[model samples]
Target: MNSRGFSRRDLLKAASSGFGYLAFAGLSSMAAGAGSKASPLAPKAPHFPARARRVIFLCMNGAPSHVDTFDYKPELSTADGKTSNRPGRIPGAKLMGSPWKFRQHGQSGLWASELFPEVAAHADELCVIRSMHTDLPAHPEAYLMLHTGNSQFIRPSLGAWTLYGLGTESDDLPGFISIKPTGRNGGAQNYGSAFLPAACQATRIGSEGQPIADSQIGNIRNTKLDAAAQRLQLDLVQSMNHDLLKRERVNPGVEGVIESYELAFRMQGKLPGVMELAGESPATKHLYGLDDPTTADFGRQCLLARRFVEAGVRFVELTHGDWDQHRGLKAGHSRNARAVDRPIAGLLTDLRTRGLLDDTLVIWGGEFGRTPHGQNADGRDHNNKGFSLWLAGGGVKPGITHGQTDDLGYEAVEDPMHIHDLHATVIHLLGLDHERLTYRYAGRDMRLTDVKGVVHKAILA
Candidate 1:
């Protein structure tokens, strides 16, 4: 396959420089978990006592309608067909009320529309932030901003930052796992490591709509080589990699490959069992709504997230769809809601029952919220001015709404929280002060929240 007629293995068969002995020693220790102390994925102490040991970010890719989902505004409902006189409002666009009814749920009685009845049942565990705002209304920009602190420039993602700071609890598994992510809008940028060590990047399991039933990690497996032969091959590859590093002096690429090979070696033994769900009870599958065809895809992601977190992964991200409905808001949002509602609720319940909820921060929201006003037709337009998201478990104050939009649900009017602040809070919950958790890159200190963001201490439990 190379320019040289012979393979490296074939060429190296006659050469010996103690490379085999050195690699075998390193891999043997690594397999026993003794070598992880020198690894970048080794567990590290937090900056402070962390409220959460892990994070699960439930990302709804397309903007979901805040007015229809979580931020129920009766005023917006009453003034359904009214045109806006507000500046910057689109011309002649009428306000559209949510097709579903809003009702109080759980002992907390947080207002949520009928679209998310399942999630509403866990209202007592939810800390709903009603007045969430972001930098842009556009999908690509806001989506990027929601994941990485900066939109215009490539930056480490939230998961990457978390993994970089905490270094994960497991050496056998990836620190960050992104499930069923969409390769659109922000694409890989949403989970990329950027200037951070490539080891901090997320290990994506599957794409958005693709069911990962037989979906194993795609490449690097040579069916012909057994575990021992593979290890020997990897030893040779790693020796070459280290040789490159010695020559180049500080090559992140080579360093990342070296680490990846070792991790892959260790993962081959554990990951297949983790991904297998045949052992899950029928009740467990039913709990996640996996029995239903409509909800199966997202349900699978949610369940895998739980398994991954339980297996000591530090951060897990599950993405579900283009919630962006510029037209047919009711039908589209309804379908989307039905798909994720039970699965999300099941995740909450499962975590709590397993005692994982106490330290597993669960976040649910999209890049932005759809506007109260219709976009020419019946659908809501993108509204970066205001939106909503909810946090549960971890250290968040439960069953309380901390902010609000105006009565018309047009924009955040009180206790408005920006995306930067949210990022700060997320990092804070994971025991890293966003300001202090910085990586030196390009002669500057880079952080998840950048120079912006103040943790919303009021929402802290």
Candidate 2:
């Protein structure tokens, strides 16, 4: 209960008036009193000490195959071309051996396939989770589950929740950012703050050319009237809104407008530095594979992600789309892998070299993994039963593989981690109580993990 003896739900009722409520009611309340640091995303002393301060989520939109990439099963090699009559979607699917070869690397003897030789160099930095499972096999549903905790309902994204719970390290930028996300799979709803304030929603910065064009302050014709002009305009607006607030103190839309305008004005000057890769040398760009045609686009995105986090953005999401390889498996997977391989490795290497890896959590995986068996005699279908995901930096054990799958790589035989568990562990790394970092919505307090989540302590360093 709050000081008002009201539950969080009651507070939401009191505060959730559209823009008017947010601007006048909420901001006014916050502004009326000085010395109040009440942003939902403000960093707080964790329940326990935290090992990570920021997160970079590399979201592979299409599922990548665990059997082909990270999890190597010797039995698949021997049982190549054999048919399996399992109770799966395809009645009699032919056994498929990985087209690539896996070799043990580093001191940990972690096996990485030829597809990601760049990432393989950092094998010792990865904690591979082989037994990861989810509820759905389809992209829309599974992607939603992976991102928003719930498959059906709109809710605060984990990034938004993180910001709300922890607050911003730099008030200039949005705490959550999503790069080149897919529009179809859950769309903007994936990153929407839902019940959380609009401030916590991801600031969508598109591919080069347009960098926050809408939010920047308009150009002033008179340079001489700069500060005085802005102050005069601001004061005029505030006076009008203040009078309006007296009549309707609970309008969220009105309140939201005022808050949005204020933040946007403040962000105008700070945004350019945040977006620019200011001092990045040509050598650094080339190392990230930006010089190569095949890898350039993804490379730019990865490099930008690093730049954003360096500027103190709390959460950064890097997304590349259309990994759904139902046919032409070799061509599809190879193209997808080549596009991101070097850039990803460069990000890891750059972070480690800059000493950011110690406090920055890096996650790599898709909505799910591909089925070992072919869907149409060529490509694999989506498989949510079992898959592989990996984490590096931010207190994760390096050069380790946790859990295993069946001989055919169909089922998780050990240490299965649900998506909820992954969410919980992520929150744990950032010093949040997964269960307690919640927003009141629809009469219940909604959390990222909901009622299901256990921290994967075994993988923690």
Candidate 3:
């Protein structure tokens, strides 16, 4: 204080009497020392009792045809060659029935098209939402709306919001992870944390067999320094930062950095054990289709997701790409479905066998659904008006279909569930009150479901 002629008074007053100082001391120890247990992602009890403790978000990059996949419209077949009076950009558009037939599968008598035989087998475990709608028709905007509740610009992704609301369940792994193929739309924006702390951001891993990164410490081999030596070096650095913090108030960026380093140090120790895939049996690998050339990569990703969530990661996201079927609907969708179907069924099976299904939520769908009317000769355009998504495990009422579209499958005719409503339901399942869980940003308190959202309680078990 003498060198700069400044006392602690120059800084912003601590929020609590001495709690701020105690927090600072803890932060300091974390920055310079190793083995710090203070990860923001560390699991903690929710604000209330939660029905689900984890979530697996299977995002189909391009929208899929709900009529062809899950929503069996018998009338669509009869009206296949006829024009429709449905309200849309393409008025009086010709109806397009699915090329495949539908059959009731499982004891639930759920109508599923031939495209998803594997998923159809698990019909009793699914709560199919046929009334999901969104605000945008374009890919990026729809994606933003689905993930962040806003189509305007950057905001905290759903994963980040979940992390902020619930923290982490495992100190070793990130609370949220994004599993992606090589080239995909929306890029990192789909998983980025715009304003929340960086720790809330998704830790992405490639579907092409790459580690998240070389997580080893930068200078792990350079210095022969022992643990005691490392502690001293960290202490010196912390002292310098504390002095600087005394001079400058409201140092969120600095504080965030300190917290990040501590979390990284903790991760470095426990990550290796988590990455070992050899521990899995050969039968389990084959169940996920890991040996099939077409499904191998995506299957591996799904397997890893199961592994991560089993280890207590709060959320895990997996994406399989190129569903933008502007043409060649048959080939495009078949390939996409082939890549994911068996692996997804296997994931549910494995989770159930491990007794994790009841506590883990599994969600599968795209940003939106494809139009029932053909955009080109063979393909459908974006239809945000209504689509289908499925949820399994957690507290979802299994073996049930929740909503329906009109006879032509053009509009949501019953029990409309908006994207915001879906978000609200997810938060509710996790024991979070969507309206009350808010963060102050840009002079307003922002939430996942900004000003609108209604949890669909009827779908809950």
TM-scores of all predicted structures:
0.92, 0.86, 0.86
- Candidate 1, residue 210: how far the Cα is off, in Å: 1.5
* Model 3, runs deviating above 4 Å: 1-42, 89-92, 181-185, 207-249
- Tens-place lDDT digits, model 3, residues 131-167: 8899878998888788888888788888888888898
Q: Residues 190-237, candidate 2, lDDT per residue (tens digit)?
A: 787777776677766563223222222233122333433443444445
lDDT for each candidate structure: 0.83, 0.76, 0.76
In angstroms, how far off is 96's CA in candidate 3?
1.3
> Candidate 2 — worst ten consecutive residues by lDDT sum?
21-30
Top TM-score prediction, candidate number:
1
Task: Enumerate residue pairs that collide in model 3.
Answer: 32-234, 41-168, 42-168, 43-168
How does candidate 3 fare on TM-score?
0.86
Write down the RMSD of candidate 3 (Cα, Å).
Answer: 7.2
Candidate 2 backbone overlaps, count:
25
Error of 3 at 108 (Å): 0.9
Ranking by lDDT: 1, 2, 3
